[model samples]
Target: MLELQCAVRRDMLGLADGDSSAYVVPDSLPPRARLGIYRNTATGALLTALRLSYPAIRSLVGPEFFVGAARRFIEHCPPPSAWLDAYGATFPDFLARMPESASLAYLPDAARFEWAVNVVLHAPDAKPLDLGRLAELEPAELGHIRFAPHPAVQLIQSAFPVDAIWRAVLTRDDSALAAINLAEGPVWLCVRRTTSAVAIDRLAEGQWHFTAALLAGCPLHAALDQATDAAAHVWLATLLASGYFTEANLEGQVSNLPSGDPAT
Candidate 1:
């Protein structure tokens, strides 16, 4: 019975992709519909998960194409975990491989940006770093410091204006999408949750360098050195105002930070 249950779990999850013709008539269901139930349920769950993760993409592709591509994608890459949130990690790659249009090359990057936004919305929350404590740190000790950004913060860089694309679809103004030139390439963006709303900020060239540096665990001075001179202060102010970036020391101590664990 234990082995039968394990086989049922594996086959239903599509782990038995190679061949399971021999087991299709197992006594799980009436012989007439033995494996049909598993097939329907598994496919339905996969489609639902793909839709949840890529609603914008689904909208872009219309229901028919979206369903077709989703079915194909699921066959190649089954969900990795039982957790729904963990599904759809490979969707962007699957889209990028489609030989549709050179001009539509940006679609996959847009999908990736959307996925990152979803992660930011669901990430755990942490209190902002204490400005006073940071001010007292000696310059030499800065390198040893490792600060944690808000778990709800996500940074994404794309070779397309994915930020603009995301906004066009989500905004009320339908004409906003008409203004987009697919020829335009590249955008760096930050997605973070603040005041109970998830917002996406498109970063300028200089801002991208600065934020990327900070995210890479660089020290303040080092990150500043890497930033465009004019953007240094602006980036610092933005980071602080966003309420991201918790000091490494205060991480485990939930008492030190506000809203230690965030909602999914």
Candidate 2:
């Protein structure tokens, strides 16, 4: 029974030949024909999840091409989790490794952006840090301050113009998309969400690193040390105003919700 089950599973994933000799057919039906239906259905379901999760990729490649790529990806990277939303953790890497899209180099980064968007959307809610209270802290005590990034704060950086491409595809702005030069830039973006909607914006180098350090559990002053050419106080005020930090330095400890897997 175990051997038969293994064979069935392999056949279902198109890893083995679904020969008639391997199985008893009902009503003398053709084994290959029967197996083909199940195989196609399973592949289709997985493909649908990829298509939904990475709409920017689908739109850029076109449905036919994206489906072909997704099928190949699904064959190797089956979901480890039963939750479809939680699957495809490795899809951006899969796209990056594909030789066919070597010319469209930004494709991988665009996939990363879309994935980050989904993650931000699903992240749990947290109350904003009380800025008024923060202003009351003594300068000496503030130096050791550690900050918590909201659960939805996601940091994403790409060597290509991923942010522009993702935005164009999502908004269906064909002209904007056409005007995008993939070689124009390496973008650093912060993607965050609130009850109303998700927002994606480019960040300065210092800002990006500062947020990254904070999210990685660095203390406030230590994270500030990672910044470049910026007044830590003013910039930090902007980050707080933008709703990045949730809470800061409680009982001499600063803590925040996990900001999903880091996007590079």
Candidate 3:
């Protein structure tokens, strides 16, 4: 049974090896016809999920073009796991390699932005920081502070105004899409899930660097300097409002970061 299932999957994905005759075929359908049906159905299902995962890509390339390229992309980079939401993480980079995408350089970044949105939507819910607890800390304790990034947080920086392009696609506003200049950025963005839904926000240069450093395990004091170098820092009250950092640690541990951590 296992071998037959493997054979069916191999044939469906067009990755069958030689000795196709070795697998026993059902009497009702010819082998080639059955294989073709399986292949179409499997690829069609993948294409639908990919389109849903990347609506911006579909909008930019149109239905026919997106489907053709996505079919080819799936052939080259099939999903590594059955979890579809986590799939296609590498698709934006795959788009960058396509000759058709050369003329539309922002397409890859826009795909990445869309992918980030999808990821955040499926991320585990996270508690926000308790500003009251943070405010009580002595000034000297700031140096030892470690911030815990929310699981839903994702940071992105792009050479093009992909954020604008993504927003236009979401709204289906053709005029807005047309007005977005490919060279308008270097845009910095952060994706985070709110209690009700996911949200993306443009970030200042300093804010991005600061968050990036914290997200990478940099301590509060040094992250402050890093953020202040590129942008201004107003400190914890303002930081908590962004919903990026979920907890503040002073002595190497979370005191308590409940899902319902009270807001100030």
Clashes (backbone N, CA, C under 3 Å), per candidate, total 2, 0, 0
Error of 3 at 47 (Å): 0.6
Q: Per-residue lDDT for 1-264 in model 2, tens only?
A: 877776767777777786433575565567777777888887888888888889888989898889888888888887765588777768989988999888887788888888999889878877777776666578776767677768888999998878888888889999998998877867889898966888888987777887788777677777777678467668777887888876677335434222232221
lDDT of 3 by residue, 1-264 (tens): 887777777776667742243664657876676567767888888888898899988988989989888988889887777787787889999999999879887888889989989988988777676666766677898777887877888999999888888888889998998897776759899887878877788887777777789877687777776666533456344557867777776656755433353543
- Which lDDT tens digits does candidate 1 get at residues 27-90? 6565326665767788898899888888888777778988988888887887766887768877
> In model 2, which runs have C-alpha deviations exceeding 4 angstroms?
1-11, 14-36, 130-141, 247-264
Task: Give per-model CA RMSD.
Answer: 4.6, 5.5, 3.3
Q: Give the TM-score of candidate 3.
A: 0.85
User: What RMSD value applies to candidate 2?
Assistant: 5.5
Candidate 2 local Cα displacement, residue 206, angstroms: 1.0
Query: Rank by TM-score, descending?
Result: 3, 1, 2
> What clash count does candidate 3 reach?
0
* lDDT by candidate, in order shown: 0.72, 0.78, 0.78
Candidate 2 lDDT score at position 88: 77
Error of 1 at 81 (Å): 0.9
Candidate closer to the true structure by TM-score (higher is better), 2 or 3: 3
The prediction achieving the highest TM-score against the true structure is: 3
